[model samples]
Target: MALGWWGRQPVAVLATAVVVSAAPILSPAAGDRLIGDTLPVEAADALDVITPVPSSLGADPDRVALGRMLFSDTRLSRRGDRACISCHDIRSNGASAVARNLTTDGTPVPRNTPTAFNAALSFRLGWAGDIPTLHDQAELALTRPEFLGGSWPRILDTVHGDPVLAALFQAAYGHAADREAVIDAINSFERSLLTPDSRFDRWLRGDVHAITQAERAGYALFRGIGCAACHQGANVGGNLFEKVGIFVTIPNRSAEVLRVPSLRNVAVTAPYFDDGGVATLPEAVRLMARAQLGRELTASQTASIVAFLGTLTGSFEGRPLTASRASGTAQPGDTP
Candidate 1:
């Protein structure tokens, strides 16, 4: 246990932690420990690292369909080559998967583009926790010169020119191409981007076969070493701000603190962190362990934890959220 310096009662927490950290009691065919390790009710109640996705996020079909078109319409950009789809593409796990998204002119954006999947579940929006809602974030992104570089007039002009899109908006909101209706439609579509039914979630719901023994061990270690303090709640994070290097210094950005990201779909959202500085799961595991927890994990341990993270990959619209992992995903020890 990493409880020594953290003001925890070593003997008490460790004893219970041991039972909670152990492997299943028997073989799966025999149905013993079918749902894996059993923790004390108290211990279980104290943690919030895992939460099941809401079965229904309450999306309006009309708004979603209209938002789908708006999300892809490049005319929303000043350059006509960018749109909401440029960075937060639904086909790519709602992230562009780049170190930093760039403008049409190739200038770099300020920070990594977060995935839109499950974003509505987040308590606050943006890496800085600056934006309050998905609707507001969409508006800022649309108008910001650094992002979509669009104004209401320029975008409304484009929307008014498109008879099909204009009619769709009119039908959905009793009017054509207004700022409020536009953002509302986009927000509705984003609400439907929740990726549910991950293996971890299935395990949470009492399925024994959802994850492997090593993955379970990794989860135990994750709690034992205290990685879940900030990364808790339904989203698994996106609840608060966290310093990047609480235990160790990260050069160039050691002093900056930002909002913690939700790890629900982390296995597929590669090029991690605010700057997208890390590339592989294994590498990120090692660095975060050292920097955040003051722990140095072995490759075997890292692999196990990373394996647990893989079970976080969930499905969207009845398919894998991202197309990049269609062939296969990077294993624990594979190259980035």
Candidate 2:
């Protein structure tokens, strides 16, 4: 008797399911055990922050303006095709709708693009926790060969050649645009992407009518079942890193390492997880419950949590416009 297609598989799906279901509870180290120590209690106090939301960096008006332009500039990429918004779209919860977007040459990048909403609050940046600050992360992305694929000199040239960009940079930085100023401006704008006026935040701020009964119940279940341990901070999960399969490895290549993502605007950002394997919110909940909690969630529990997560969606104020090159548009030899 020959093995069928299903039988030829190395791991049984049901067995893998069992492992994911038992992993979270059985292994105490699966989630962020450092939640109590790392996330400051001050994060919960909305009034302390100047913007009424949790932020890890300071905001400067000029820097944010510069960042906004760079974020939308396609010239930042080596092939002049990709921008910060290419992967992390501000319209779609700050993440791309597809599993992954292509590089300038159309090569598929691995891993789902994480949301930029409230990303400044994360203790670490990127799916691997590789970059610590927004500025560093921006610089890495801009200079990475596989990513933007452009050198600093070329990027500076492209930006400086654009008139609209040059004017914007001048207004924002109070001088001619430079490489460091460009990076700082983008970082500042990113810092302003924090979203904290969700119904959950309102409820936490003593608004009894902010969230629905179902959402409230879901919040209780989230904490009661220990989901809150890692996903409790202002952004609701960006403050920590966690391995995907703790007690048992899920039958997937990308299961080993993952940064716990912020659940803010989770309703809009589908195809969950770093791999973008799970398609729906309910499936994401089920997968997370099984993988992180080691418990099978009831249908109602999943529904309520989904309802609560839906409240995290926020609105963006303005649309970024494409600007002209800064070089010929500005006065000669005006480089900062």
Q: Which candidate is the best by TM-score?
A: 1
lDDT of each: 0.70, 0.62
Clashes per prediction? Answer: 0, 15
lDDT string, candidate 1, 78-132, tens digits: 7777677667767657776677877656787778878888888776788887887
Across 1-336, the per-residue lDDT of candidate 2 in tens digits comes to 011122232234234333322322432233433211222222222211111244334588667767777877777778776677766666446766666656656776776777777777666777887776777888877988656777888888887899988888888778887878887887788887766566666666678798776665555555555566566445566555578876555656546665667677788777677777777999988777788767778787789778867766655553321111211121212211
Query: TM-score for all predictions?
Result: 0.82, 0.75
Those runs of model 2 whose alpha carbons end farther than 4 Å from true positions after fitting are 1-58, 318-336
Model 2 local distance difference test score:
0.62
- Worst 10-residue lDDT window for candidate 1 reads 1-10
C-alpha RMSD for every candidate = 8.9, 13.0
